[model samples]
Target: MIKKLLLTFSFLAVSMLLAQKNNDQQTVDEASEKLRLAMISGDKTVLESLILPELTYGHSGGHIDDAKEFVEKLVSKKSNFLTIENTNQSIQIVDKTAIVRNHLFAQTHDFGKEQGEVSLDILYVWQKTKNGWKLLARQAVKAEKKK
Candidate 1:
């Protein structure tokens, strides 16, 4: 009888751990989707909520922008995203940080009316903080177009 109870307790403990991990994964996934929508809509409030103050955002073209510069460009119509579509994505969490890999296709209208597009591979690092998950850094590499 004691052996059965021990086994049951062990199973319950494992089940609880799995549930918690799954819940955390769901939270990060939802946050990522919100980020995509916010970028497409140029929503500063949502963007501020998602990105850390010390964010390092790098572009495929070799430019790197700190949080203030990045946000300012987005808010001022210097950077305008018309669409953001993810071709594939994966997120892995370790302790308080999550690493994300995404293959993305995007369209933009920048500098008021200059149009642009990109297919890129992006790596994002997210840190879990008191306010929730905030993007700490991102690096993007433009992919070669398929014929």
Candidate 2:
């Protein structure tokens, strides 16, 4: 009888852990979607809310931008995103941090430049704060074309 109870408790504990992981994954997914929309919309308020004060945004061309510069570029339409699509996304949660990887394809219309399309593989690090998940860092590399 004791053996059966121990097995039952172990099973319940494992089930509960899986449930919580799923919930966290869903929440992170929603946050990612919100970020995608905000980027395309260029809404400064939403962008500010999602990004941390110490963000490190790395571009494919090897330029890096701090949180303020990143926000300012987007808000000023200097890095305007007309459309963004994220694919093959996977998020791994470790403690309070989430590591996300995905393929990003976007149509951009920067100020004083012609519209262009970009394809890149992006890595994003997000931290769970009291206010929710905020972006801590991001890096992008140009995506390789399939042969």
Candidate 3:
């Protein structure tokens, strides 16, 4: 009887741990979707809420954008995402941090100046904070056109 009780408690504990991981993954996934929509909508408020104060946003073309610059570019019409699409998105949670990867395809007009259709492989690091999950940094590399 004691052995049976021990087995049941162990099963329940393992189940609880798996559930927590699933919940964390769900939260990160929701944040990622919100960010995608915010980019297309140019919602500065939502964008600011999602990112950390010390964000480092890197572009595929070797350019980098700090937190303030990242938001301003979108809010001020210097950068516009006409459409955004993502594929093969994945999230891996590790303690208080999560790593997310996705393929991004977008039609953009950056600085109101270039052709701006790009495909990129992006990596985002998110940290669990008192205010919830906040994006800490992002780096993107240009992806070759898929045949």
Candidate 4:
């Protein structure tokens, strides 16, 4: 009887852990989708909504920008892209923060008429804040480019 109870408790504990992990995964997914849409649409407001006030972005342009600068550039019509693809995304949660790693494929228009596909390795750090999951920092590096 005691053995059976122990086994049941263990099973329940494992089940609960799995459920929490899945829930956390979903949260990250939603945030990522929001980010992708914001980038493609050049909607800095949406992107800023997900970002923490302390946000920092290390762009592929060999420069870094703070939350304000990042939003301004995105909304200024200076950078235009037709598509943004998030591929092979993985998230790791540690306490109140999560790190999402993924690759992005992008195709841009005009702006020197640059048309090609580029692969970028990206890292997004999110913090669980009073509001909700907020993007703390995002850093991306160019892995490859095909012209």
Query: For this target, which candidate reaches the highest TM-score against the unseen true structure?
Result: 2
TM of each candidate vs. truth: 0.90, 0.93, 0.92, 0.83
**Ranked candidates, highest TM-score first:** 2, 3, 1, 4
Better of 1 and 4 by lDDT: 1
Q: Model 2 segments beyond 4 Å from truth?
A: 145-147
Query: What are the per-residue Cα lDDT tens digits for candidate 1 across 21-78?
Result: 7877888888989988988777789889999999999999999999988888888878
Write candidate 3's Cα lDDT for 44-101 as tens digits: 9999999999999998888999999999988886888888898999999999899999
Could you tell me which residue pairs clash in candidate 2?
Answer: none
Query: lDDT per residue, candidate 4, 53-97, as tens digits?
Result: 799888877798888887776677456667888888999988779
> lDDT of each model, Cα atoms only?
0.88, 0.93, 0.91, 0.82
lDDT tens digits, residues 1-147, model 2?
999999999999999988988888888899999999988888999999999999999999999999999989988999999999899999999988999999999889999999988999999999999999999999999996322
Model 1 regions more than 4 Å off: none
